[model samples]
Target: MKQTLVIGASLNPSRYSNLAIHRLVQNNIEVKAIGLREGVVTDITIVTDKINFKDIHTITLYLNAKRQVDYYDYIISLQPKRVIFNPGTENPELYKILDENKIHYEQACTLVLLGTNQY
Candidate 1:
């Protein structure tokens, strides 16, 4: 499986981002995480900055719309096959920009997708 970057990842176990990481890993999916704090989620390292991740087939967002604004350019630069606007991260402006760049995207739940084997 190609890599999936989890933006807005959290070290907090209760967070959906945290749960997603464990699920992704268990499903044998490669996951790269970006969070406010640098830490480890199981074997995955959560970095605090944009590090130009490569071969990223999917980017699953965990940030809210406003917070996501800061990553618009960075996300576009990654050129992932698709961006998953998970729950609270949906942004219309970013969607337009992605459309202009010809990047595929969807507004859905990452965990749901993975759980259903539809990811």
Candidate 2:
């Protein structure tokens, strides 16, 4: 399983980001998370700062396209193997940037992918 980073993570259990964190852990995939406010989802701490994470194979975004603008460079800098747009988070500008940098990306739902064993 790929080591994944869950961006826009939330403390709220109802948020998909929170659910994804739990699912990823349950599946035995190494996972890290970040969000606006510091909190915990299961045993994973939701980091509030933008720190570079090494050896990250994938980044699944939960923020909307607008909210994602600030993290574009930060995310690209991480240079993960791939970025998952995760439904409403899709941004053409970021896609172009990723394409130019030879980074792969997918506009899909993380939960769906996990449920179908496609993640």
Candidate 3:
């Protein structure tokens, strides 16, 4: 199974990041959630830091562009096969870095991808 790291994950039921967690698990994708807020979703506790991540196949971002700057190095170091910039999370600078690293990137919604059977 492809292991995905859900950046900006939240325990709030109303949040897209939380929804992504549910959707990813439903799709049989393993998920590791990283966020400042700590709580459980579907019996899995959300991790607060990305420093120990390894074998990340994909990273689906839930954070907006401005808040993403501080995480650039962290994300890049994960060396995932791809990064999905869902909706409001798009960043050209980050895209450039991913491009330089030969990492695949897509600016699209994770929900849409799951709904469309493209995830």
Candidate number with greatest lDDT? 1
lDDT of 1 by residue, 1-119 (tens): 76899999999999999999999999999999999999999899999999998899999999999999899999999999999999888899999999999999999999999999899
Quick one: how many clashes does candidate 1 have? 0
Candidate of highest TM-score: 1
What local distance difference test score does each model get? 0.95, 0.92, 0.89
Ranking by lDDT: 1, 2, 3
Over 4 Å off in model 3, which ranges? none
Which is superior by TM-score, 2 or 3? 2
Q: Model 3 compared with the native: what TM-score?
A: 0.95
Q: List the residue pairs that clash in candidate 1.
A: none
RMSD of each: 0.6, 0.8, 1.0
Candidates in order, TM-scores: namely 0.98, 0.97, 0.95
Error of 2 at 23 (Å): 0.5
Question: Would you give me the overall lDDT of model 3?
Answer: 0.89
Give one digit per residue, the lDDT tens place, for model 3 in 10-99: 989999999999998888888899888888888667988666678999899998889999888888888899999999898999999999
C-alpha positional error of residue 40 in candidate 1 after TM-score superposition, expressed in Å: 0.2
Number of clashes recorded per candidate: 0, 0, 0
Model 1: what TM-score? Answer: 0.98
